[model samples]
Target chain A: MAESEYILEVKNLCQHFTSGRGRKKLTVKAVDDVTFSVRRAETFGLVGESGCGKTTTGRTVIRLYNPTSGQMLFDGRDIAGRMNRKLREYLTSNIAMIFQDPIESLNPKMTIEEIVGEGLKVRGNRNKEDIRRQVVQMLNKVGLVEEHATRYPHEFSGGQRQRIGIARAIITNPKMVIADEPVSALDVSVQAQVINLLNDLKEEMGLTILFIAHNLSVVKYFSDRIGVMYYGHLVEVAKGDDLYQKPLHPYTRALLSAIPEPNPLTERTRVRIDYVPERDHDYSLEHPSMVEVEPEHFVYCSPSELERYREIIQNA
Target chain B: MIYDRNNLPEELLNLPASDFEALYQEDIKDEKFQTKPVGFFKDAAIRLTKSKVSIIAFIIIGIIIILAVVVPPLSPYGFNDQNISAKYLPPKMPIVEKLGIMDGTRVLKNRKVSGLSDTDRYPEGSIIEYFNVVTAKGQEMCDVRVDAYMLAGMPDGEYHWFGTDYLGRDLLTRLFKGARISLLIAFFSVLTNVFIGVVYGAISGYYGGKVDIILTHFAEVLDGMPYIVVTILFMILFGSGMVSIILALTITGWIGTSRLIRAQFYRFKGREYVLAARTLGVPDRTLIFRHILPNCVGPLITRAMIAIPGAIFSESFLAYLGLGIKPPNPSIGVLLSDGQSVLLQYPYQTVFPAILISVLMIAFNLFSNGLRDALDPTKRGEE
Candidate 1:
């Protein structure tokens, strides 16, 4: 197979978790048949309400959680099969994850050097000086000094720790990073600092990031293309501007309306859209699947709703 | 909570976007910490030093340990030395004789006044005073206080600081020596218990489900077994010595440590750092020992400290039950058992050992409590 421009392609990815057995067997489809693609060196922002499978999709793509049934292609190689040592090595080496909670992401017992240098160490780089040098360099890249490498995670603030998390993730020189809500637990001022840092690092390293977050505005600003998810389904996919200008799915529209505008004059006039799927879509008689509403814009809708969305976009 | 130049949102409802503008534009360079970095252990040590109760307890423990090491060999009497004639000798000190406390005095009651004058039965100048006299059946019975050392035919300048036992073993020498054995047993058994417990609990707690259930149930069943019965089994198989006794303590002792470690692993294995390590492709062994285990070291160390006293007490109890370290080999419990038999006659024998054991127990208990407080992260930087 020829190499595709898209670095990671996940098709019909379903991650279902089952607990107990026999009479009381219960299954939770956290990510049910979610499909999306991340191009090489582009930020693919996934925005949703809490428990909408955004984090699960990112984890599933990174092979943290094994997909229940799907086809995931990383660099044109199938990764959605049974995990072996070789497959795990390939996945982890190419893809690193940045956790949400900065305090929780870094090990408290370890120094910054150990935490950041771990990927290299695990990959069989036994030279101490080499690892230390690289760790120091990575720290510098994240605007940290060599002295900071000796300090523990608890010594640093939330934003600093998140930067350390970023440094640790990208230090291994992974092609793709699954940043799971990297700035949800930081102050607004600190949030901008981290985001700017991530933006700079992304440009420098040419890293493809599957940025999963609930905050729509950050996702909109950071992401080149954005996918909106409702429940366990991918509701819409479009460019950042297209997603803002014309949100095709009702759920996406509802998520968009929730973003508080900066202008007080416009804020008062803002209409809140509540997405009641039962009231919005009638899928009993008609079947719906992901459809191309316009070039570079996709929405999950039945025929009647697709026509309506098309008319809305044309009018806009 | 997104706040950038374009995506400010309503976070700045009261404040202006310019407030965050400087932070967004500025590069992320972290400031150097003003104070010196305090590591977890250094932090704990600092906190521990601040607790005066712990400091005093620590000093007492240190003194006891030093005496345990220094007192036995330097003493005039060996641990098992038998001066058959000098059995039940009262405590004596040279300078203290003027004050009359532990001055080797014994009150002789129901002694006939005629017998008191007899030099053969009562040594010459041994009788100090006749406190009470009774005349009955034309016989004079008197109670006189005598210098016990002179009564026992001990030479001048000879003294027994803690007196002697029924076997004429110096109570002070035997007590310290027994403390040595008891402490060693506690140290060794605790080491073994923690090692076994950590490994067992790591596996059980890290790998939950059927394995955890089976291992947990097995530990419960073993926990149900009578420790006395287990000790008895060890006595039969290995015979009672330091090894057998340590094994006896270890057989069931590790269950608590294992339970502690298991619970700790259950708490820490799911922590985000462990997950981060897992995502980094850190192997299972590294995850278990390095990632999750280190996080719970404070609690583990405290548990081990508490377990030291527990092991010592268990050993003492076994010795009291007549299953202690073999005869002539002194343990605190063995000495206590021997002293309790002659408790009424020579309460001094029981008193000295009893005091040392109580001090040891109290000191250890206090030390562990202080350690728990010191190591507790929640109480960090507090008084």
Candidate 2:
């Protein structure tokens, strides 16, 4: 792949936290050696269960949490752990985040205008009129009116609040947006509306998105390529449709089987596959690393398993 | 049949395509009726006015303030003025005298004259008469008659409203002046405490980890100290005055506010909104001041209002113990202490100051309660 084709490429990213005190000190690997690349203007979905470090990875990429050790290349420049003011400012302005909970993501004390225009103000847009105009434009684009700008977040419904969150994220015209389970908190009906709005905005703004969620179905619908994580490790990466049809990793297969089908016959007949690390592989003998099994497909497996996976793909 | 139906259906054929173009056009018109955004303080103020008890408390406080400012200077008698002749005079109502309801005049007879000459003692306009009087035991006695100048230049007989203290100082005037001193101390001490506490707490809370640990431990240590003991120590060290009392109150007083602010900061600092602001490249100063601090304002204001009454009470307690304001300055505490000594003899002295203190405390408490409810975000929009 050409270097400029990928807007963000993270290599060997690690974030470890120290817990306990003194002699009993322990390091919990929140994100361990995760590597992935997001192509320009393409959605890269990250799927994982609770405590699997999908959110951690998104945050670390945006420098919300400093990576313990890694290389993050944004716009072909290494931004991982770079503490300079200019680089920090550039990264923040270029990348924005949509948090999981809309109600908590917006300051209740601030009106919609201040919340949405905060980014512009931070980036040095001092003109009040200009900020107001831009905020109104963004709000309207997200299906809100000008009068809504003056109201507090508490007045809006969950769907409207999420739209405000979306407006705030995109008002600065960021090149990349990290949406961390943006619709997980909304009702099923509202979830579809929010997802559609995100999809529309993505196309209109040409934004590269790192979409993180535990819902595999939503991830499949929204992403071009998907990465499956388990216990702080990215176990598989493949095209969205390909991964759903033929999951390479055991964990991915297990996660896919958990999704209930609409047809009762298929739902009842579906067999759940559980991936336990102890029974899965002999890591003591040969440790697994992410390796390419096909042209654009990657899986975390040892030499023997990798050969098995390749043969299985060839047979299919 | 089809040909006949086509000929008859002119109404159906005349129907043109209905235009729905307006529906597709964006509804960008401004709202016909819009409400101006209500600010945090304005909303709180509206809520505050809704409570009747709070309004009554507010009025009481206002009246006290007016009396504190306007009453003392208008009194005929100075706070320290002493008239030995009027030392133990019971209150005599001037209105009653004018209406002839009572004759309050007192003529002292059968009393021995003093050694000082009558001409030298009495002022120029005085009328002094010497008379020989017979007592019940048939002993001869000399009596002196002198007309006394009472309140409003009334001679001898009149009512002394609120009476007088042991030294013949007007009780009403002293009470008003004492209120001024007490209120001044409360205001200053609360201001100092809140200023120090907020700054300390904001810094401690915003910069967590090592800075938080150190500062929190320091606050805990200060909190562990006995309040009255510390106050007494400060009084002894700095000597008794307004400055010393305020310093003593503030030293430990701010710890509560600081802790409250610090706890509030901790709760808000981890909130997603604050994190969102941080991710938006907002400077640390703006994040602390604009984002985090403003949310803490409601609780902080309520806490500060409650602290004012605590300060006033502390001042009075210290003054009552004789370690507060000096004698002539007349704090409520000082008045109470003096009144308590002669409480059995002249109960009015103790009763009057006690009533004032009770009213002040109740008013402050009621007002603070209203403020808390008004500023609470959770209670907003509820009746």
Q: List A-chain TM-scores for all predictions.
A: 0.98, 0.98
Instruction: Evaluate fnat for each of the predicted models and list the values in order.
Output: 0.54, 0.48
Proportion of native contacts present in model 2: 0.48
What are the DockQ scores of the candidates, in order?
Answer: 0.51, 0.25
lDDT of 1 by residue, A1-316 (tens): 7879999998999999998899999999999878888999999999999998998898888777789998999999999999999998998899999999999989989999999999999999999999999999999989899889889888899989999999999989999999999999999888888888888989998999899999988998899999998889998999999998888798987888899877766677677889999998999999989999999899999999899998998998
Expressed as tens digits, the lDDT of each residue in B269-329 for candidate 2 is: 9898988887788898898888998998888888887877777788888887778797788
Which pairs of residues have clashing backbones in candidate 1?
Answer: none
Chain B TM-score, candidate 1? Answer: 0.92
Q: How does model 1 fare in lDDT?
A: 0.89
lDDT of 2 by residue, A1-316 (tens): 3569899999999998887889999999999999999999999999999999999999988888889998999988888865779877988889999999988999988999999999999999999999999999998888888888888887778888888998999988999999999999999877877888898889999999999999888998999999999999999999998898778888988898788765454556667789888898878888899999998899999999999999889887
lDDT of 1 by residue, B1-383 (tens): 22234434666555865676542465667777777877889989999999999999999999999999999999988889989778899887778878989999999888899888889878988988985788989999989999888888888887888898887778888899999999999999999999999999999999988899999999999999987887898898999889989988989989999999999999988887887887889999999988889988888998998888888888889988899999998999998888898888889888887898889989999999999999897887565
Worst 10 residues of 1 chain B by lDDT: B1-10
Instruction: Give candidate 2 misplaced runs (Cα > 4 Å).
Output: A1-3, B1-39, B77-160, B225-241
